[model samples]
Target chain A: MTILRFDDWTDPVRPVKRDVIAKLPEDAGENPPVLFVPGPGHGATAFAEHWLPHAAGRGFAAYALTPRDGGKLREHVHDVVQTAASLPRQVVLVGHGEGALVVAHALGRYPARAAVLAAPVLDRWATMGTALRVNPLGAIPAVFGGRLRWSRRQLLSAGAPVEAYGRSSRLVTSRKPVPKPVGDPPALVIGSPDDRVVPRKSLDRTAARLGGAPLLFPGMGHDLMLDAAWTDPIEAILDWLTKELSAAS
Target chain B: MQDTPDIADRHDAICVIGAGAGGLVAIKNLREHGFAVDCYERETSVGGAWNWRHDRSPMYASTHLISSRPLTEFPDFPMPDDWPDYPHHTQVLSYLERYAEHFGLGAHIWFGTEVVSAVPVGDGRWDVTTRSTGGGAERVQRYAGLVVANGHNWDPAKPEIPGEFRGQVIHAAAYQDTAQLRNRKVLVIGGGNTGCDIAVEAAQQAATVWHSTRRGYWYAPKYLFGRPSDQVNDRLLRLRLPLPVRQWLYRRTVGLTVGDLTRFGLPAPDHKPYETHPIVNSQLPFYLAHGRITAVPDVTRFDGAAVELADGRRVEPDLVITATGYRARFEFLAPEILDTDADGRPDLHLHAFARKHPTLAVVGLLQGDAGVFPLAHWQSVAIARWLRLRTTDPVRAAAVQQKESTRPVGGWSRTKVVHTRRHWFEVDHVNYLRSVEGLLREMETSK
Candidate 1:
């Protein structure tokens, strides 16, 4: 019942130097900015390659964050919340995979304009179960408290650059109940049925928790931000955010 | 409600008085819950007490946060990581400015507009009258609810000492810079955090500094074990350790680090640690040891430029600064509505929701061991949720109102503190935040 977090008080999550890539539209609009948080292994370049520029070109101020500290989930959440606070206006949070969990944690703190969860890893047990079957060697390291190495096939579908498969980082998971966000901002969940890392049921559960059905991007892999069909998901998010923000105003 | 020629009807809109830290967050939370809000501020900008430019702000030039950044900043809008553990008042103002801009709260605030009165017009609605600071025609706006967050630090509580002094005497609220203290015999009265801060400043600038206190206080160091002391103390608070154990730990630590105050010719604290508001100043003790400040007993009377202490010692000073805290003043509303006590403090349930009116509430009025901004944010969130519940289900809202009326008073203060006017709203930060969280859970589950 007492939500006074002592861990945060005693051992606070200090800010770290994060790699951020930002792109502003030539003619910036009144729409809220969108901050992109990449999943484990991937950095800001995951979104910077296509999603940030594409979204900015579509009249939205876009930013992608690579939490270089690689600390606990709260640190990543702190990075997202602190970065979002620094922006000129309230931002829409877009988190992918492990980053989606960080965004959910941040949602409990920051009142974002909107939220977008792409290829969300809602359940670690379910995701690791799928990973074990799809790529056994990559999933074995995760079980031993090491970084999970995602194969090129696991990250992207077709026509993606070799560098798109990001460097591995230690992934932390928790079973605590996600805090109900203030304002209960509108949420849009996106994933592909053919993704290797996250199963369809996991995406559906994430959508159910956020009060929506997943917007399926067929024939795509786990890395929606680096997939050959990354444009579709980015466009869908920009369109949904535009409508949500306009309606709220 | 009917729209008249003069008074505008803000249909379903909530009216918030003040755009300082409390009012700004109130507006943000209410808007987040889908409520249109209009906030009126007397000053031209925000940052209620922290805004030094505001005429009534109590902030001096050298003021820094007593609580560390982690304990002080809002949960959502944290202070920048690069800032020090204790940031200056100007940094606080800029942080507030960043919060306002990030949340787009500037659009809803009416700068330089002061609320004249807020009269409850049945059914939780209020008729709020306002006037421009630039001296314009008065305007009245009717709203569905009212949130009074005009802040508690602006009004100075100048205590009466029997006789008048011919010297330049000013409350800490009016003491701005070193110009008032330079090369003069300065007597800083009261033992609160502000008093210790002013005394330290006087030690730096004044020719001779005499610090006066009615009673000895437990002086908490700004740091303990290489970290901010509040952060270290929070470990015990988080573990839900008993009050006696926590106090013992604090006393032991202070004894080891600071030794004894009596050894420095100051009175030993009569009360236990945590009995009074924690004075987080390490500099005061340093100055006392260095002979920059002479500790004196309480002043009994003022004779011309001379002051007589309780210990039969007389000290004549060129200027006197009374750092005796402040009283919460709600000038726009009737006193009886908030159940004002003899000490001019409001007796609202949980120091927030009004018992008489379901929609009337106040924020940022309590004194806590930690930062006030996070507490204000939580209070605003609870108020916003309660207001939202009122519209969706009036029956449940009325039940909550009934429950609020019966809720016990002073549950968050941990234990019995010294019964002084200054301790009227003292709360243990952990306990108070937990209670507010409990209230929020009740409202959400009932809905």
Candidate 2:
């Protein structure tokens, strides 16, 4: 339940005030803790709270990154790696939805104890096209930081589950080459076959690049963690962890 | 200590069972003193329980060494410094491989060989028989001595849960990974360390994880004061602090950090702390506190997947995992040769030597909180030297027999691990180690 703030990665020389939220474990020990990266615009408290408590209860020190005026996709990735490296040892890094892309990008430099990318926004255009279909006025941006500009009201109210919305405007213009995961035995990607947000092809590609199959529950959708059967995805991750860890050892 | 003159040469080979941790160390110690040793392992690999995929491996997915690396590593050969403090099961097996290779124990090891039975004749000799794993050949080789290094965990101790459990039930020994638990509601029976570990994993993967315990258990964190808990305790023992002071210190530490079990809805432990084996789980209590996992009473009965608790509540789970402990078994040896109490524990004099037969020695046979590796190492040393000196020095052998100390082992009570069924052999690490030191010293000191 403890909240910790870490320096933002976008301004590494003199990072900004604590924009990230992490639940410091009561005790940190041999087993490394988990670092969670929520999708940009959606603060850590709103999105990452769902599983951080679960991780803590299971005895892992849990963390959540909150990029308020979220930066470029790589900046988010840099922030995740920096935070993980700062920890005592390698940690399990989990990113949800668009945040999954950040985690996948981070995996190239800092291979984690295990990486979980859930419903990634791999091909930015396709993901934005899918979002545009839902909100023509709210075509979300792909990059964050000061590159792209948009009104706060327009970005925050986009239709998403539980007030957890990602700013599409902060992403549109800063168009550097988007990072695709070149993961060796890639990160454990979690995708939804029935996801309405991220395109099916993008999700499949994410899994294929990661080298492990996507854990897609039959009836679950894009917001698997917030779904009534949320336990399904969590369980899959746990089962996958058992295999991954045993293999890593 | 110099090896005694042999009536027979190295041709008088000693037969060893199962190339497990105990068996490997036993073979190495015996070979160190010039004993011709031929070890048998049913599995091709040298590491026994640490070999995850081996059929005999009872290790679950989340298994890590309860004891730390430095403390658990062998005396002469240490684990790689890069290994984590509490190395995972795979790391442990690899360490064992390195140990086997370093000591050249693999040369005399007969992989895919299983000991069928060991029978001792009237005199101090044994008829050892072994069969190749894949129906290759049966060899009945006579040996001067038999070292039963085969551990006690092979036999699954299935607690008879009264009533019908129509749902899928599995013993923890049979559990391989978490695949079976995913997308299913699981109920874990028993609250031992294994049970707690499996229950914690089940909570993460299963639809709903329910934990049932017969009674509350004392819990020990993996580390204390930035070091492994066992190492800290070993230090405390080295300081030679009084027993009461140590117990008091431990009770205070656990009470302060872990807090009361009743606070987490778990029943208070029936016995005092350190009375039995404390559950060495660092996570189970946390989950229990958050209500992520529901703790229930010992099961009264089961109807299908539905389990009725001692309290009237019933839960219909998809899978029921019995994380029950194992019973000590010596199936390969003659039942009559080793006498026992009412329960099945072999009534031995020094936890290693047989009271009736001098030819048989069960090394590393007892349980202790301080990693069994060091204890097994010392026990093997004592047994090897004792085997060498018994006939040569009768008075010293008698002295070794008479030097039985009231060792205070964690989880020694008949009611704890053994339950009402049998006596669980618990070895106090300090006392047993000291007594073995005394035995080793006596072996040297005697004329």
Candidate 3:
């Protein structure tokens, strides 16, 4: 439906040679591939640490993207869309935090088999306000077009001390309204009520846009894929995809 | 066709002709809308015209995309990020192959099965009779709808000259490689992209090359300002700048890049840049500048091994390749069903929905300044939405039918196109897509 995207038509994203971290099952099943997109400051390592291997272990072809540093939302979305197209089959887009925003935009272009948004920063202003209240040092720099840094306590409740990669990156603050996904792909929103980066209302709003309620994971932090209990959410996602896609086909 | 008891009853399925890019997307989009589709491709493989192996393909050895990859690829299924700006025909074929594979559309496609006829069976259904390409018994299957995407490029439009020439004359459709032009005097006719491409190839391979055109055309460069020219043009279009402004900008860019083409003995362009199907060939100008290509006026007559020009001159050429373009032809469906215009082109609503029948639609029937793939994709998606409306709310569908007739197709073109068979389906990409978006919004709101 976004065929008349003039900006995209005129200023298309240039192709950059980047690596995609992948973990394939011993015997890949007919299940759709799961492509995980990390949010700002997070590399593919965020998912490659646990979620990717776990999803692949659960009989899916799992892949993660290491998006270019300091890319805008459009560029990130283009990268995710292009990577998904290169996959053997339709993929389940699993986006974390700001990557979820990219996934939300990508859904308008890509007809994903299913979508999973983990602690998605759907409302940038609301997330910004929350960050300002709790972590002024990280949020203030981000306000002036600088990188947003996150503390280990902010990203994960319990895990090995957060890597430097866990710090927040530059944020996109475009005022354009979110585009409704094409084909209305079944979507699942996963978030933690105790997350410090994203407010609870933003999660509810995102779920509402997708015509669903967020599957809340209490006591978990902002980085669901990198959190100590990463397996819990990955299992929930795979289980939902198995049911929804089977019913769709 | 025999009415055998084995005739399949697929009332729930839609029958799509030609498993090219258009047909493949039609099948995928309809299936996305929860409609069962049965797509038939006469060729053994997919990619339609992009597949050189297909007998109906008009592809030649030097056939690279005139438009860049971003606009050329499907919006949902993009070409590879690593692909060049303008991919070659083989890469295009592989892209289509990958598209089919990724979407799992191959299962729906019936390869080597050519639809012989599609007769509407009173109701909103069609009795689609198909036969195997390798001479087999014809089989008829009943379907709820029919989509014509056989493509218009395969049917070559040979030009008419007064006298017969002794030299071997062939349509560009048949010109496959330089082997045909090597060591021979070549006369490349027409001012289309294909004509320019062949002329450039002939300059490299032939002993002498004479490019004969009826009128001079603006040969746009493939790139401008270090970016694909079409993208730059689209930016202006996206800004909704007035037609005059965009046209002025276009002329300025062309002036700076491909300065006065008449310096190479080519005539001044008879019309504005947007007034014709854009011929993007930077090499044509390069060849013309090097004196490898001699531009001649229109052909007046053919005099046994020599072609007489409009001016008082004659040139003898061993081979004549006419790239005069193609006409839209649908052999399977009755011509009346398409509601052809005075020019015999299918006068569809939005160049998609057949005015006469709600269920009958056509995809990839038009030519735009940009790539046709995205246009074709949106057209199919609109068709699926309309078909769904026809099933759910017949009243709204009827209202839509009435609205479609009031509007004209390709009305968003920047300038009045020169009246020619080639420009019949010409449209400005950004404007046309905006109109399509308008129609989609209407469909959504009405629902």
State what share of the real interface contacts each candidate retains: 0.88, 0.00, 0.90
Q: List the residue pairs that clash in candidate 1.
A: none
* Residue B422 shift from truth in candidate 3, angstroms: 0.8
Error of model 3, residue A91, in angstroms: 1.0
lDDT by residue for model 1 (B68-97), tens: 999999878888887899999999999999
Q: What is the TM-score of candidate 3?
A: 0.96
List the candidate 1 regions with Cα displacement exceeding 4 Å.
Answer: A161-163, B1-6, B413-415, B445-447
Residues B109-193, model 3: lDDT tens digits: 9999999899998788899989899977889899999999999999889889899899999999999999889899999999899
Tell me how candidate 1 scores on lDDT: 0.87
Which digits, one per residue and each the tens of the lDDT, describe model 2 over residues B1-447? 213222232246788887889999889888765688989898998888788868878888778987666557654344544457788898889778866764568888999888878777656788766777887556676787888887777678887878887788889998878898898999999887788888888877888899998887788887677666776777766677876798799889989888887877788877765567646788888888877789999888887767899989999987888887787778788766778655676776567878788778887777765667877877787778777776677777767666543333332322334343322566556665666666677676332
Q: What is the DockQ of each candidate?
A: 0.81, 0.01, 0.81
Task: Report the poorest 10 consecutive residues by lDDT, candidate 1 chain A.
Answer: A161-170
What are the per-residue Cα lDDT tens digits for candidate 3 across A63-160? 99988877777888889999999998988899998889889889989999889998998898898888888888888987877777787777888653
